[model samples]
Target chain A: MRLGPWKIDVEYGHLALVIVIAGVTGFYLADTLQVSRNINNIILVVPLAMLLLGLCLLVVTQCIRFRKHPVQKRATQLPNHERDELEQEQSPMDLLHAFLLLLGVGALVMSYPLIGLDVATLLFMIFALLLLGVRGWLFVPIYAASFTAVVVGGASRLLPYPLPTLLF
Target chain B: MLDSSAILGAISLLGSDINIWLVIIPGLLIGLIAGSIAGVSNTMAMAICLPLTLYMDFLPAVMFLTAIFTGGGYGGAVTSILMGIPGTTSSVATTFDGYPMARKGLHNEALGLALMSSVLGVLVGYIILLFVVAPLGNWVIRLGPAEMLLVALWGLTMIAALGGKRLSRGLIAGGFGLLLGTVGMNTSGYVRGTMDIPFLLDGIPVVPAMMGMFAASQLFTLVGSQFLIKDKAARRADYRRVLSGFLSVLRYPFFQLRGTLIGVFVGAIPGVGSSVGNLIAYAQAKRTDKDPDSYGKGNPKGVMAAESANSSSEGGSMVTMLALGLPGGGGTAMLLAAFAMHNVTGGPQFINQNMDIVYTIIFGNFIQAALLLVVGLGFLAVAGNIVRVPLTILIPSVLVLALIGSFAVTGDHAGPITLFVFAGLGWLMKRYGYPVAACVVGLLLGRMVESELIRTWQISGGGELAFFLGRPVAMAFAILLVLSLLQPLIMRKFTAWRTRNRSA
Candidate 1:
């Protein structure tokens, strides 16, 4: 992308992170002020939230400047074709794996109270194992079931509070 | 300071009871197992075992509890070195370097260094406690809100130091953590940021949040990796390397001594204990070293400094419990409960009348420290095999365990919910260049800093400058904090000047 005679490679993920930080800071700062403007109440929150917002702005500025004047590598450092191959090998599949795992965990936690911890855990384990490329349907269910049994069973006995469960 | 008659009586008391000897190993084993698990803390371990102590005698009961205390101190370091997860808050600093070392296939050495440091820390802490418990207790109690506020600020200086090349990102993460920490209710009775969650009334549950940030976040990052240690040959748990790491600790006496002293003094303070002590020690070690940048990247000194301080804090916390009947942290609070169960109060009178019992406890800790050296070696040998597990199996398993552990910590749906939310936040922060450790530190100290600052303001008649000027100790800490903040710049200048002079 070109902006005012300068070429830049913008990383959307990094930019999104900065935006998220700024949004959280703004929300918290506004909420704190709404609670009260009393010095004692807002002493820690007001200053910290402002500091975070300031940092986000500074980071955004640095990101643009650094992207505009991205560091140049010597021709002898690596052949262009090899560098391209290296970048290809890195891939984005790892990210997809992470995202899937995150979703799996979220589903398990959200369903914990509704479906019971044991069933939720068993479902999460199977989903995770499959997503991570574990094979053999016979092995997967057995492994997931036994592991869930031991963990939930042990936790049920050890923990003071009862873990909501459907099956013993 | 030495009571001659009490020392002799303590020796006799130790020899008179065989039951005390019997419970020591079991207590240590129980503590070791509990502390190595991701979410289970030494306090939880003690609480679970508290009922069993009711059946034992007073001396044996205290001895058993202290044995657990001593063992749990080092046990947290196990998972910290093997995995990125810190088993307890006290081992947070340990993960900063120990985890890096493990990733580099040096798990054996890191575990050995942690074990040796913990043993010596306990020995030195107990020795110091024996001579100066009374005086230290008196001095520590004199520290008011002003001093504690300074101490919290001193720990906060670590945020800047942890920033490395990206100082602003570190600050942002830390600031975000500070704001998040004050989520539920303020000390002044004004609430903000709770989002109407009832559990937020007590503030974010720190242990569960920590489990998400460190353990679950790291597990997410490890999804596609083949193994924790990429090189198959390097994953073996070699006893020789462990021994070498053990022997290497003796060479860094200065780091060990400094960390132990910081642990003792910081641990003696009520409401602030090993969690902050280890951070302060690690920060000081990094600041003072000739090569400060090597710290977070896997410096042995970082592990040594953190472990020594956290382990030694056991004895430091004992000074308050023994001399003033005040518990410094949860572990000591459990000990206090056991004291109540046995119908023996701990105060100046208790110390004066039962001097032998006090000495007996200290001496028993000495033995426990020695036993830890042996038992800890066996435990490390078994625990070191974590590197061999493939990431396919390890990642989901650890995530599930962390989820369960978080639930155990908070005892409700809120714990799992918090863990899930923080896991996503931690992952994003890590994917960017933000320092999660800095955020964790900020969260830990946020409530403390706010409460102390409020108290200081109230005591100083609305935050008067003259009130701070009159405090010599606070002034001293302020000066030290300023100097530490400036140390990196000064060192840079000095090095540049030396290089120019040498070239000229």
Candidate 2:
């Protein structure tokens, strides 16, 4: 189940299943190879199997352990002072900012190759402006124009960019 | 003297000369950017830039990477101070108290402490590398597989030493890490775990895995908690607080020296580096303090211990790189990759033959650290304001950059996909309390150990116990490994007995 400050959230069950599948598939592949019991190879395989098994075992242990102790009950009745002290470890603002940043970065990454770097930068800038709660098309073009200047001026001079051709 | 100078002239080369000012600024700038973000490590920055270096001349490329290295070192302190999330492994211990200080609005003091510690750590580590690396390089070059194995084992055992009182978990993680590392290839021409995925033939790329483990897991945690957060902090942000905070570094050199020594020694060891060093130093500082309980509760000493020690380790790790032809830490490994690309053979005689380039590296470290101190302080003063950028645009753009950063290496979608794959696995590992970094380090050092073992085994015709343990130096290291593995167990039993006796 839960170990110390770390908990094996129920959601990781899917991941555990995936690992099990991977392990089995790996075992199957090892068998399929039809390799003889070479000492060195066995030395490698045995450890790999054990490590995977250990990971799976640990995950399973977490799920089993926490099922016996719900989060609310555990938090309220915790005997240890340290665990009690860690009750409000994460703040909402921290999580939100991280997600917003993650989402923004994810979107920009998926779109980069489709549009050229400059266009991508301009569009991402608009999206970023929106994330910052700034509404207005006025800043959009200004953002693009300023970014374009920065990109062109900066890249041509300061950056070590390779083969960044502009599509007129 | 002239002949000596000629040889020195040949070796002091850093790389193909590039625009110095342009490179350092960008390097520092990117490092600052990356370091300020949680889970984006200095190593990730290096890996992302690895492919880019193939195109540039050597020195500029090296300079750029070095800049990122310097900048990344200080950048981690920002997130550690502002948010609980460590921008790097090194900064993890800082979160014990740094974030609490920020929450109390002593943000300037905490930030200042972090900056000072970082600069001091860097200065000390660099100085050590300058004096120690060249002298020891000759002897270290003679370290065979046996010695290297001992060194690797030393790194492996650090988990047990620093894992708080939970020594069993640390040992289990470390042992399991070694096992995970055993996947894929062996020195005897056997590919045990390949199973047809050609990508795994070379074993797992620890960098991508590390990113997944450390970076992606944090992302998943962020995602899981999404939509529950409210926007606060409508008050005006101040830059002066950031400046006065940085000025405090000059005021506290003792903290710097203590932290630096701890960091450098930890860093010099082959496998471990800033994170472990930082944690150990912080804990030690706490244990020795008059008010030990003050730690993990907004103590300035906590921040000083962690930040200074973490930065100091960077220099120690470099010493291993220069003297022993060993990569000190993950960052040094990246440096090694760059050296390899430049045909820079850095074994025992490297410095003797090429003092200029060698000295340049040492001097470059000082210059890099000096520049990073200024850069980090300046950014810490202003980076808080960066939060206002719209998520919509910044998200998509950064995503592109991250993807490009990944793909730029292998030149395929595989790299980005690999990044995500690592991220997904990392998420699972974190949720289940699996030792993420331990597994990665195990995997990273695994192949190297096996390769050497097999080489040594074959070299000695079946690796007889006598041949393996024959050399005195080799025997010494092997003895160290045995003791390292046993010490924790002995200490635990001794403590338990003492407690029981006292109870009786």
Candidate 3:
């Protein structure tokens, strides 16, 4: 990962992500330019153009950096010890856990409209506890249920409107 | 406006009302506790307690809610400093330096600084509000759409300055955020970026998005850590150190005053209030400081500037609410509701006819400001213990709060969904060298800038250049903007020249 006294340790996956994001933004900007000349459209186009420019520059710079540091291109595939010493070790399990928690949160949100707030919250809380590395099956339900009840119950009483839910 | 009879009436009204005194402490305590929690907002606390106001007399009801407002103003700083999760938008900039200070084992000091600055800010804000309620209203109204647009632009320049070493990366993140902000429907009935999603017609909710980016993403970064502060000794709260931190604010009276001024003016502006005020004050404090580079890296003054500006904005926002009957934001909206419940109307006529009531409210706020000093110290002492909580428990618990909080914001699933999506984006941005702060700033200013720009264009009949040229206030703001953009480079070059001269 060391290239001419500069240490670069970006993974290939992250680099590809940068390219993808930049490409999407650039595409959006081009599409927006063709829309119109109204005040609202112009307002939208200016910042979108600026954003695309910034993203393109970022992608170009990152590409140039990678080009300059050919040896660092395969830093993600480095032998374990070398990678560990150079970059703070993030295990694949840790990455998976984080990603799973995120997915669980998304699921929790999407399920709310389907089932209801109360049920969705109860289910999500338990799922979140598991994803967050909570153990003891007995405590999980107890904690999730009570937490859901308090939040959902409080919102029901205090907020101006009833929180949408299928099952109370 | 300041007739002796009015002053006497105000004093007598306040003195006769034992009920007003009774509710102040309890209301403040509720606010402090609710605000101290990561997801619980002052507005939420007030909303929960709003029904209680229905039973009380008019002055006591308004006084009670205002007490909660004052206490909650400082309450958000606790978690922002300790956990890097801003309990409210007002405390967002506080996270920049305050959290770093906490990580460096100065959590107690940051809390004390925030509290003291808040107390002073509220005090100064009320004092200014008392004298200039009418005049200030007239003055701020003179700000045209062009001027307001410049104010938002002024905020954006800070993004480049916010990016520590990677200015370009910060600009990229900020630009992306600006683009993201424009995703929903525009004022002109055109929806550009919302892929035909029905809910997005109203645009992405800013508060939930903010919580996900700053709070949840930050928690993700802190995974595997047992304690927030790595230093064991720094983890414990020291009362003496807290006292020392309280005393530290006196050393920078000018900084506090500057922040107070910024807060009052910005807070008076309807729609854009304390949220923008705090950021602008922090940026100004950083830009003017001798060691501007030290800001956002555990600097005490940064905490002072943000807290002072935000707290003082309460008084500024009140000016519009009381004198103009315009609710500035959520908290003030609650206050306006209280006014309605009391069978009172607040406008120019209200001030003219009910000067006694106006004086009483201002006087009550002064008392609340004094009480904040005492109640806030104890609250800080207890809230500072958050560092001792292990990450395993703290993370899940805060996540729960954040989820519930987002849910409360929209009273729908949209809030949590936005939080989850943005949390992932924020995590990745943080993982890279992109300045999340810049993106946040961009997100906040994006709508305001565009709206103002459109308004200016409409007012000018498409002659935007000539309109801006005619507006002296906008011209002044433009000059300020150019100076702000050039200041850092100018300072750096000046310093280099001085260094060369010294060496020679």
Q: Name the candidate that leads on lDDT.
A: 1
lDDT of 2 at B453: 61
Candidate 1 lDDT tens digits, B1-504: 989999999999999999989999988888898888888988899999999999999889999999888888898999998887888888889998898889888888999999999999999999999999999989988888999888777766665556435667766877777778888788999888887889998898888888888876578777777888988988998999999889879999999999999999899988778877998899889878988767776799999999999999999999999999999899999999999999999988899898989999999999999999999988887899989988887788888898999999989988898888888888877777587777777777788888998899899999899999999889888887677556666777989999999999
| Model 1 stretches astray by more than 4 angstroms | A66-91, B488-504
Compose the digit string of candidate 2's lDDT tens values, residues B273-295.
Answer: 66557765775676557675576
- Model 3: C-alpha RMSD to truth? 4.4
Residues A29-90 of candidate 2: C-alpha lDDT, one tens digit per residue: 46525564755555444555555566455645544434444456466566665573455444
| TM, every model | 0.95, 0.67, 0.89
| The candidate that achieves the highest DockQ relative to the unseen native structure | 1
Q: Candidate 2 docking: what grade?
A: incorrect
Q: In order of the candidates, what TM-score does chain B achieve? A: 0.97, 0.70, 0.96
Error at A124, model 1, angstroms: 1.1
Per-model chain A TM: 0.83, 0.49, 0.67
Candidate with the larger DockQ of 2 and 3: 3
For candidate 2, the per-residue lDDT at A47 reads 53
| Candidate 3 lDDT, A68-119, residue by residue in tens | 5345346688875455334533467766776676776678778777788789
The interface root-mean-square deviations, each candidate in sequence, come to 1.1, 6.2, 2.6
Model no. 1, DockQ: 0.69
